[model samples]
Target: MKHTYAPIGLYSLCKPLLFRIPPEKAHKLSLRALGLAGSLPPARYVLKRFFSPDTQSLSLFGHTFINRIGMAAGYDKNAQALDGLEGMGFGHIEVGTITPKPQKGNPNPRVHRLPQESALVNRLGFPNDGLDIIAKRIESYCNRRNKRYSGPRPILGINIGKNKTTANAQAYLDYKECFTRLKDVADYITINVSSPNTPNLRALQSEEELEKILTPILDIRQKSASHVPILVKLSPNLEHNTRTGMIQKLVEWSVDGVILSNTTKTSHPWEGGKSGAPLHDATLSLIQETRSRFPNLVIIASGGIGLDGDLQTFIEAGADLIQIWTALVYRGPYLLRRL
Candidate 1:
């Protein structure tokens, strides 16, 4: 059996101090500290030995993953804290919903915490550093690791999106550009068609629009990076038929898998895309549904997962992997160690 680390209760203790500040700023501060910690020789050495991630490898999509828990895309939108994230013990880190260009996203107060519900509402959109810079940053990182590393490489998944200003018909090009530009660095790539904050983005999930985005990428795979597996991230709010239709298209396109959610747009009491605890049951159901309909399709469940019970439920419900974001906020860094 794999040895589990003890919770340090660091985030539990510091959260009050962190939460006092705005959510966005607190996130920045945490990212910076994580980067500093990841860069430190002592911190990295100690963490590497302490956690010693179990060699629980999963062979899928032509790659072997040492562990199933991964840090989802949104948290490290710009890929700045990867070293720190790696130090925190995630076996894989999916970075970005990056666009072809840098976007300012929605204005402040975007990330709202609902402590009572254990959720976060955000309309931050895809506010990333754009293709040129991020692609360069990761390409260099991949090159360095490739040159020096020997052990299994953490699965690096790049999630790509179109610029908010980019119109529908042209969005395919944006995704293709990012995929082509970062192909060498990405162990796998995700097509993000479900961010609620991006105007008409979910429309891309529809059969007509989804084909435009997915078809071209596969068209170029043979002449391009043929082996990099591709997956799609779907929205939790999708209707049953819409979900089934999307999966059918993925099967046609030879897409590798699906990440069962990106937050949900709710009403009455909630606003924006609601993530964390509130999204748990819905995500698991989607995973079960998608798995039943398409047995071979790879499913990575994302949403309200934050505990061992939650993880077990997802894994047993046919989830190949489960990704978490909000629980880390509610449960803290110790959550990663515990997993």
Candidate 2:
């Protein structure tokens, strides 16, 4: 595997052009380009070179990451861009809040950019190609590329959730459907109950509700004889005691890890789930609190971390791993280089 490396200066030159397009549209183009480059050694090399590849690999969730930085779930909702994300040298990549069936998510204008705050508000109610489709892609990724790689495999996590129409009474079925499909292929699994876009979805964050959802998925793992790490994604808005209770339950339940947060639901001069620079301080506080309570629990910190220094700050605050979303969109490809 050899590469025709791109000069380090190319990405900065392309930043203005990417920003000119709609943010979502630009995101799509970047995914496609990275997807193509991922299959070709030279192109992948060039792509990684532009980000100034980090040589360190850290172990977590029974797998080793090429670095601590990871791309969060919403970035590649359908599992289509793992190769490309890996090409860019993300230590890990999470795809999907995949549901039992495909959905249109929220209506258009569902995602908006706030350049002034380096933040974004998205009401994309888990729009994805669903479990079956995403599962197949993961299966293909594992069989085709993951098997042959002798080097460190970029950690892969499948993030799962219920559909918008599914009643809360039966949400566990949607989660089970996705978990059963993805468990075999995923290095880790994330139960996403924090997104503000779906009605009543946050209710699942309660300890009783969360246990109802996670216990069954844990059962599936037991039944299948798998030890894949299972993690719960949390909302940043939970009251401190409520959040601590949830972490205690996760520890008691013997779950593998917890994602510090999904996007926030606060009214911060924007609508929908607020992410990016605005989430930095709140996320750190939450991670610190969570780590204090459950010292051994794997904490994947995510939220308002846009600058490179934020990664170190979170890591020092007891986070084992970190994820990024709005930052890539606002800071362009160069941002990850600093990490």
Candidate 3:
């Protein structure tokens, strides 16, 4: 069995100091540390040995996931930390909210930490290195690892979104471009229509607008020799009827899966979406409702998953997979093995 002990010693010592820095800067620093460690073979091995989860394997979408846990999309937005993150024991590492063109996201002081709530409110509007550069990064990362390590590595999921400059009518072009460019390197692709920071991006969740986005993408999927599972990340604040209607449309279109939620729009004294403990109830409710309604649809539950109890509760509520972001901020890498 996997160890349940949370390794908090060093992280506890470092948390306060790290927290003292601005959230986004701290985030970049953390990823840079891991990226540096990953670039060295000996360091990568040691990190992997210490942090890797020993869990039963799961097969989904023609790939093997070594564990149920994945690092969610927004954290590694540019795909820069894949090797280091994989070394730290996530069964999957999702990157991006990447757009067709490189763009600066929301301005600084965008990501705020709520230490007491263990939550984050970010309007970091999909800041990324764009599709072309990130795709090469992923491709290069996979190539380097394939040549060096023969053991299991984390599954790569590329999450794509439209550029801020793109109008709602032309959004499908951006998604199509990203899907086409990224399909080769990705084990799966997630369509991000749910981030509250992006204006009118959530508007695509409407059945009519969504069909516009999916039709061409599905056509490409059918024609391509390779198959990549496509998933949609949704907002937690979606109304009952709207959410259900969207899922039903996803089913009809034969989309592969759905990420139960992104974050909540309940950011008070802030302008972005809220994540962490506050999102747990909504995520759980969405997973149960979706599972009960569509027994076979793949459900990747994200939001408010930090503790061991939260992990178990989500799975029990019918989450086929779980992704973590805020939890990593609050609890550190040790939370992976603890779960």
Index of the highest-lDDT prediction: 3
TM-score of 3: 0.96
Q: Going through the candidates in order, what is the number of backbone clashes in each?
A: 0, 1, 0
Expressed as tens digits, the lDDT of each residue in 243-271 for candidate 3 is: 99999999999999999889888558788
lDDT of 3 at 74: 94
The superposed Cα distance between candidate 3 and the true structure at residue 51, in angstroms, equals 2.0
What's the residue-level lDDT of 101 in candidate 1? Answer: 93
- Once superposed on the true structure, which residue ranges of model 3 sit more than 4 Å away at CA? 1-7
- Give the CA lDDT, 0 to 100, for residue 203 in model 2: 94
Model 2: lowest-lDDT 10 consecutive positions: 1-10
Q: List residue ranges in candidate 1 displaced over 4 A.
A: 1-8, 49-53, 267-270
TM for every model, in the order presented, reads: 0.94, 0.93, 0.96
How do these models rank on TM-score, best leading?
A: 3, 1, 2
Query: In model 1, what is the error at residue 198, expressed in angstroms?
Result: 1.1
lDDT per residue (tens digit) for residues 1-339 in model 1: 111112246656777787799888988888887777777868866666665445577888988887888899899888887777776667789999889899999888788887777778888989999999998878776776666567776789999999989998899999999988877778899999999898888888888887888777877776773578899998988888988987898888888999988998865364578887777777877888788889998999998887655666898898998887888877777675565
Clashing pairs in 3: none
lDDT of 2 by residue, 20-95 (tens): 8876787788788778877888887886778735657887767888888889989999888787788788888999
RMSD of 1: 3.6
Error of 3 at 269 (Å): 1.7
